[model samples]
Target: MELMNGVFRPYADSFVIFFIDDILVYSRTEGDHVRHLRIVLQRFREEKLYIKFSKCEFWLNSVAFLGHVVSNEGIRVDPAKIVAVRGWMRPISPTKILSSMGLVGYYRRFVQSLSTIAAPLTRLTRQGVDFRESDGMIAFIEARLSLVKQIRSEAGFVCPRRAS
Candidate 1:
C-alpha cells in the first residue's frame, strides 16, 4: 500500500485511487487530466514502481481495469478477456478438451446459443474421439470469431426495460 500511496499522492486532487492496483484518475477538465497524468508518472518514478507502459492506457473514455471493463458508458467484460474467448481452440486430448471446455463454459452465458454452437465439439468429447480438427471445428472457430466484435459491444447482456 505504501507504494500505491507514493504513486498516488501527487494526483490526489484530481484522481481517486481504488484497490491499490486500480487507479482511477478523474479530471474536471481536459487540461486537468493532462496535468494529473504528469504528476502521477513522476510519483511512480519517485516510488520506483514502473508501470507497464505498453499496457498503460491514457485519455480513454473507458478502460478495462482488473477483471471488469470500465468506460464512461458503464462496466462490462474486459476486452482482454474477450480476446481469450475469441482465440479459443479445440483441445487434442480428452483431458485437455475437458479443461478447455470448463474454461469456455464459464463464459457461455456471454456467448449466444453457446450450447448449439458447441454441440458438435461437445459430442466429440462424449464419444471419446481423439482431438482432430474437423469441418465442425473449423465452422465453430469461424462462427465464434465472427461474434467477437458483436459480443464485446452492446449484445453482451440483456438490459432491463424501464418500468412505466
Candidate 2:
C-alpha cells in the first residue's frame, strides 16, 4: 500500500496501474512509453526494490492482469480464463459450488446483475443452510455460463479517469 500511494499514485490513472504486485505501464506512443518506463524503473531503483526480469513484461500491446486482458482499447476476460470457466462441471458440494462461484465472482465486472444472479448460490453456502443442488444450482449454472459468453464478446475493462 505504501508503494501504491507513494511511488505510483502520481501515475496511477494515467501511465501506470499497479494492482498488488502486477504493474502495467501504458502509453499511446513508443516515445511516451519509453519515458514512462524510465520513470517507473528509476523510482524502483531509488527505492531499492528488486524485480525478477523473467516475470516482467517490457513492451506489449496487451497483457493479462489478474485473469483479465487489458489494453488501451479496454479490458476483457482472458480467453484462457474463459475456457476454464466454460469447462466447469456441475458442483456437487457446497465447497465445490463456492470454489466455482469464487472464480466467476472475480470477473463479475464483465456481467451485469451478476450479484443478483449469484444470490441463489451464495445462499446455499451460508451457515446452517443445507447445501442443496436445487434452485440455486440452476441459477449458478446459468450465471456461470452466461458470464463466459458476456466476457468473451461484450466485456471491456473500463478504467476510471480520476478528476485531476
Candidate 3:
C-alpha cells in the first residue's frame, strides 16, 4: 500500500484514496472524473501496477468501501454490518466487551454519542474493574440495540419485527 500511496501522493484526499490495493478515484463532474481516471491510470502504468478489469468500477453515484457506503447522501453503515451487530452476543467479560467495542467502533461515525452510549462497556474494560453480568449485560444489550436503531434509521431501512 505504501507504493500505491507514493504513486498517488499528489492526488491523495483531493480526488483519490488508497486502501491496500483498492484505489478510489472520485470527482464532482463527468469531465473531472474522466481526467482523474486518466491520471490514476497513468500512475498505475508508471508504477507498473495492474488493476483487475473485473474489479474496476467507474462513474458510480455511490460505492461501498471499507464496509461503509459512500454517496451524495453521505456515508452510512452497511446493512450487512447492522445485521452482524444485531447478532452480537452480550459481552460477558472485559475481552468480549473490547471485541464488541472494536466492531462497533468501525461505524462510530454513523451513530451519535457512541462513546457516551458505550460508556458502560468501556468501564468494564478498565484495569481492576470486575465484570458485573446483570448491569453490564443490560447496558450491552441497550447499547447494541441503540446502535442498530440509529444505523437503520440513517440507512432508511425499515426492519420488520421478528415473531417470538
Candidate 4:
C-alpha cells in the first residue's frame, strides 16, 4: 500500500486515491476524467497491479464504499446498515455491550460525545470492574436509544411513535 501511495502521491485528493484493493477516481469534467483514468491506468501498468474489471464502475454520479454513500451532496448512512442498526437489541452482558459499541464505533465521528456517554459501560470492561450496568450505564443506554431514534427518523424509518 505504501508503494501504491508513493505512486499516487502526486494525484492524492485532486484526482485519484487507493485503498488496499479499491480505487476511486474523481474529476470535474469528462476531459479531465479521461486524463485521470489514463494516468491511473498507466501507473497501474507500471506497478504490475490489476483491478477486477467486473467490480469496477464508471460514469457514476454516486458510489457506495465501505458503508458510506458518497456523492456531490455529502456522505450519508447506508440504509442497509441502518436496518441492521435499527434491529439491534439492547445488549444484556458486558460482552454484548462491547460488541454493540464495536459495531457503532465506525460512526463515532457523528456521535461527538460518545466517549463521555459510553464512559460507564466502558468502565464495566475494566479489570476488577463488575460486569453490571450502573446508573451511569443506564443513562448512557437511554441517550444511545434516543440518538438512534433520531437517526432512524432522519433516514425515514417509519414506526409508531412511543409514549414518552
Q: Which candidate wins on TM-score?
A: 3
**Superior by lDDT: candidate 1 or candidate 2:** 2
Give a tens-digit lDDT track for model 2, residues 39-107: 999989988888899998788878888787877676778889889989988776779878987887888
Leading candidate by lDDT = 3
What lDDT score is found at residue 113 in candidate 3?
Answer: 85
lDDT of 1 by residue, 1-164 (tens): 66676557655634655566767775656997888788777776876878787866788876656555555544566677777766776556656556655655665556677677667656656664544657656755765664576467645543222222
Question: After superposing candidate 2, which stretches have Cα over 4 Å from the reference?
Answer: 126-136, 156-164
Could you tally the backbone clashes for each prediction? 1, 1, 0, 0
lDDT of each: 0.63, 0.79, 0.80, 0.69
Ranking of all predicted structures according to lDDT, beginning with the best and ending with the worst: 3, 2, 4, 1
Residue 121, model 3, lDDT = 81
The reply for model 4, stretches above 4 Å from the true place, is 126-143, 150-164
Over 4 Å off in model 1, which ranges?
A: 1-66, 146-149, 154-164
How does candidate 2 score on lDDT? 0.79
For every model shown, what is its TM-score relative to the native structure?
0.47, 0.79, 0.86, 0.72
Query: Per the 3 Å backbone cut-off, how many clashing residue pairs does candidate 2 have?
Result: 1
Question: Which ten-residue region of model 1 has the weakest summed lDDT?
Answer: 155-164
lDDT of 4 by residue, 1-164 (tens): 78778889999978786786778887767898999999999998998888788999988977886776666555565667667766766656668768867866776655546677667667666656554537645755675675575455553322222222
Query: Judged by lDDT relative to the true structure, which candidate is superior, 2 or 4?
Result: 2
